[model samples]
Target: MLLCSLVAIIPLLYSVDAEQSLSANGKVLELDESNFDLAISAFDFILVDFYAPWCGHCKRLSPQLDEAAPTLSSLKEPIVIAKVNADKFTRLARKYDIDGFPTLKVFMHGVPVEYKGPRKADLLVRYLKKFVAPDVSVLDSDSAISNFVEASGPHFPIFIGFGLNESMISKLAEKYKKKAWFSVAKDFSEDIMVSYDFDKVPALVSLHPSYNEQSIFYGPFEVEFLEDFIKQNLFPLVLPINQDTLKTLKDDERKIVLTFVEDETEESSKKIIKLLKAAASANRDLVFGYVGIKQWEDFTETFEANKKTPLPKMVIWDGDEEYFSVIGSERIDEEDQATQISRFLEGYKEGKTIKKRISGPSFLGFINSLIGIRTVYMIVFIVAVVMIIQTINKDDEEPPGVGTREQGDNASSSVSEAESKEYRSGEKED
Candidate 1:
């Protein structure tokens, strides 16, 4: 009887293991405290969604995750998608600091980083593909180059070196791998040069597809020059001013010579940007960025730019709350825009500018919220309401119509108890 029982138990265990293996193959695995560690350990790259069922965003995101799971799992090195009911598994939520519902984190070798990409299935797949891609992809043909660029999508900058040795870029490629896509083209035609608009061999071309911009550098490919070119091209010649774009500037120490126009689509604004681009290329020491009052009125107004102040205005921003405006070059007229910009630069260099603070919090401060600020505020409000209700219930439970002195003592005791409970609650949260 003992031998028969052992034989049956072995088969049962094998079947359980097989079921788990199949579940992880191409489906979104449902995980909890018990199996969360095992699941993360099993996959090199796993995207885990810590969600609460009652969250509307989580409910909507569920189907997108299901749709993306199979495609991601079918890759050369599969990426597993898993979800945890963080509300039910309080320990897991606490460990990951899941303050908001439907928090997505991509775990690489058991290290977690918050996922701030798109939520749709297709965009999410493209975004996550960046994490798994090789640091430097080698392209042997024009078609391969095209295919690689297409697969890379338009989210990050792309650096492709033609007729250049792989060893030349391998180090910088690995160093800046997370911020940009690096690749080498082993063979290509002169038509390719004309296509990418480079006239020389051993040339490095940087493409910002989203911005419809490209830059090329030929020769002097020493390590320092190459690295400097790569760093400069990480941002487009004239960067656009937006929340996402501003986040990219946090690490860049260069101050922004920013221009504000009434509307970016206007012919005058387009002309202004063209002039700005010329200045940007000549003066790579300063970053050139532009914002349209029509596009981002709130941001533009922070610099004191308005329809009445001047249609085309300029400022030098420290990527924070403070900006400096040139005394005489604050406004650019239509007839003499180029000369005015030159004067503005000269004035800035001569210390002919006034320093002022932005009206509100810096853009980077708002972008630092792991989840959206509205969601964080909502969570705080809900917790405060619950604590208030609990305190009221405790007060109601007190015995009615005690002696005056006794009632006062009871009230003090109740207040003290509430304060202690609140402090303990904060401690546990921390």
Candidate 2:
């Protein structure tokens, strides 16, 4: 329902990847030596049913899994259903205490939660239901989404970004029936554009996927490239949530600044407080925040499940370990330093909760890329269709391979006398 478009990319060397196997209903993911490390970090849950193709129990379970594949993905982040050849991952099977033919284990947020036995579809579905996040409840997403679209506008609203540094088009919103119509923002500001897929920040092109994206700016770009990208790759989108809603008192009139303070200890927290107080007093409209990697887990847990907001991770890794070394063993914030942050962010319009309906077009685009777009799929489908048509057009083109009235009488008599040892080798088996 959340627009899942699992894609598979087979290597030229014929290596099979479980994540890629998620491309279709019948294929299950396989975790091997090469990608096991990266696979662990890729998702929230993984339900691995390690089994073999020959075993009857495994055979029953395999088809059953395919039937329920569509439902299993309802988790906030769907579990990767990995199918390993015990012969291939023999050590892996023994590591987890699996001795049977069909063993299923559920992993939650990258940690193994529990194991359940071979069961029928109904029981398996019921058991598998417990491991996913509450927000990702299974339901008929297609019907619900179609109904939702009907309730929305007939107009397919599209917005284009114009310049180098992107500006909030909301700054240019127009008045309609006593309300402002949404704006089309243009980015013409900085020289660089940022995206998630690239190892570094800038590139020839960047992709911001929708696996967990609620809203997307993906670009803090300049106008020309922004306009070029819009016309080429992306569909028209309704920019629902604007900058005025994300933060308070942002003004391009002054330089909008961001700096990551290395505050690991309480003493450093104190120093940061002092620094912010001085900066805020000197420049009334600058934005600042701290990113503490040590506290990231707890910070992200609620933000992810309850608020449905993505976690903001820090660039620094050893914040907790080097806290004292970095900040001189002191807390951030003196009395007045703590006071201002509380007052500013509390009722600020930028941090205020927005209860409006979120736009879905951007997410749909991401889904299409993941599941719908592929040259290989098109070629395969076209070939199948052509084969079917050729079979039909052959109608009476020639005699049916083995036996046909169209063949000459001498040929038919000769075939009968050969005792069909040749015909048996070439014929389709019942």
Candidate 3:
């Protein structure tokens, strides 16, 4: 009976373990070191989550992945959601340089691309849908180009490669598909090319239909050149400073002039933006951005800005040097703000203004420096010595009752003598 019971419990435990290994939706593939390469080769588009069992974020992401797996698997060109336990499979983790847990990488044709978008299920599914279509669509006619531009939503920029092979720009298109729409036209009319002032084959043009702005790059279809061209022209003259834009500005080696305004709708903020636009246009070397102090309270705290520091205040941040400077003794207004910014720029270039280092809270360090550690110890010792001396002096003083009894006796004797004298005088008078 005992042997039979042990056999029954072992099979039940195995069944439970098998069920736990499957995804919540039961559609995702579970891969390990033995079959990772085989599965990567099998699937055209696979999203792999490199995770550790001990990671809290990985546990949170597991449910989302399971929920999204079935929907993604049902697509016409399905995407496979697979995962590897990085802690268990050390070799695979090291191969991918998996430094962080819950890292998502999208594999296309066995090549891995890091997925940097949001981690939610809906967002991940939407981003994966891009891989279902070709990276670069071919536009056969002029109307097709216009229709494509009109069909693409207003926010995304459009890139059209004229007389270039599909293979020439496919990789670039795939890399930046989230940022912009990419298309190629093989037999584009010379007239269209001339309109954009393109004089060579393999020419590329980036168009912003909403703003009626276009940029032309004539030669060098190399990845580096095209990337730089797109980056320089993709954004507006002034950018909003967020984590993404801040990294881009730092990578571009551009000094930032960050304006802290009260609110976006204020008249002063509007004027400051206009002035910043003019300044950015004139000084392409500097990146300009503005933050509303009310909206982003933490940003002001990070920069140590407060009510004492006036709003519509501009500060220059040198990303390379990791220091910042503020304008001295002058208020910036709509009329003279541009002049003041230009002067500030000139002063920065000539090293005339003071710069504060970017550092964490140093209140303790400041106090320590104001009064040296040795001086603090010395002061404490002196205070302790004075207190000890005062306590000793207090102990040495006499108590109040030491002579009170004798004084009372003397007073009693004097009273008795005075009574006797009064009695003798009365007897003599009788």
Candidate 4:
């Protein structure tokens, strides 16, 4: 009987879905005193909704909690929901000081912050936002859009596609505010959109004022993208050296070493810059300059989107004659980069051979491309192969028979008397 219950497990899994978990569309995982530590440790953010099975408020709030679950889950470190049975784990009530049913205590990253009673979906979203900044913007008018566009510059540069309603630009400006000089074409005319030809709203255009290599993004952007761009692009090494300054050097003399990086997190961005700086110091002719992709994206609407690209990208445009770049996988190893930079500058002064790497996607685009198209193809192919093999194997297996003809010769007992009409009819009379 127990083995029979396990036979249809695949069918059971296929039938399960969103409705199984309360009214709210959330993946509700149960928790109590025994697994409290495990729940807390498993996720960076834990929201424990403590309740009694008999409580009316818990039922009323279940759907609302489910509604807010998705919004909270979208943050960098996702929040896990833990439902606790206060009746069974009475100690938990005393621990959290159970004054009421439907108590929610957010934990992880140290001490628990508790809130008693139930809440609406919006309110719950608001509460979660206080802890983790969600990707959302307040866009209502022209002034708001203009301010964000202009403000993006000192913060980096601004990239505003003019012609768009103030609300749309406001949204984009609020997002990519940290990395690029603002680029705009407000009229929505062909001159702006056609010349740039972007389908997404409030696109970004990156600009490296020094190298003259502008980067552009023709899609919606976020603060996270800008944050990363600022960190990656603005290094003293990538800082544009003035052409006038280079005239001071001998004729066949100077080599520029430029390192490119995305707008990565603060910690990682700074570490890479420090390493690049050391390498640049050892080489005399190579001038190191850093340009954040986000910073340059102020003109993203104009940057013109290219699907293929790579990270921590570097390009050396040797005084208008040749520009060499490399962009496959990012190593950031000092010696490797130093050797590459030296090679690129070889022959000039035992200059390094800088592999001219080009046409790689931005980190975000690269990831999206990897997960979206490539992952889908792999999943489909694997599933198709598995299903085909299963069908072939089932066909190869012979059927088992519980009863046979030829009764003791077996036919005598198997076929009945009266022209064997009884047995023939029972076997469905051919």
Kindly provide the TM-score of model 2 when superposed on the true structure, using C-alpha atoms. 0.27
Q: Write the per-residue lDDT of candidate 1 for residues 48-113, one digit (tens) a residue.
A: 998877666788899999999999999997888999998799899878887666788999889897
Estimate the TM-score for candidate 1.
0.75
Residue 367 lDDT (model 2):
29
> Of the pair 2 and 3, which is ahead by TM-score?
3
CA lDDT of each prediction against the hidden true structure:
0.81, 0.38, 0.68, 0.48
Per-residue accuracy of model 3 over 1-430 as CA lDDT, tens digit each:
9999999899788656654553334376778976788678777888998877766678888888888888888888878899998768979977886655666888988989766555678766765766665678899987777777766644557888888788878888887776678899876677777766778877888887665667788868788888777766566667766534453453466677778777766887877787777777667667778777676555554565555666666677775435566446234655677788778677677766667764435333323333433344455456555655654555456466565556556555655564443323211000
RMSD of 2: 27.1
After aligning candidate 4 to the native by TM-score, how far in Å is the CA of 233 from where it should be?
A: 38
In candidate 2 the C-alpha lDDT for residue 350 amounts to 44
The lDDT, on a scale of 0 to 1, for candidate 1 is 0.81
Residue pairs in collision within model 1: none
In order of appearance, the predictions have TM-scores of 0.75, 0.27, 0.57, 0.27
Can you give the lDDT of residue 89 in candidate 1? Answer: 96
TM-score of candidate 3 versus the correct structure, residues matched by position? 0.57
Candidate 4 lDDT at 269 equals 59
> Higher-TM-score candidate among 3 and 4?
3
Candidate 2 lDDT over 1-430, as tens digits, reads: 2333222333423444445544434345667656554555566666777665555667777777776666666545565566666646767766665444566767666666435333555455544654442311122333432332232222222232222122333222121101111222132223222221222322223121221211223464544544343332221111111111112212112222222333234576446535554444444333333433242323222212112322121111121111111112122233454443444333232433222221333433222222322332354456555654555556467556743333344444544443233222211111
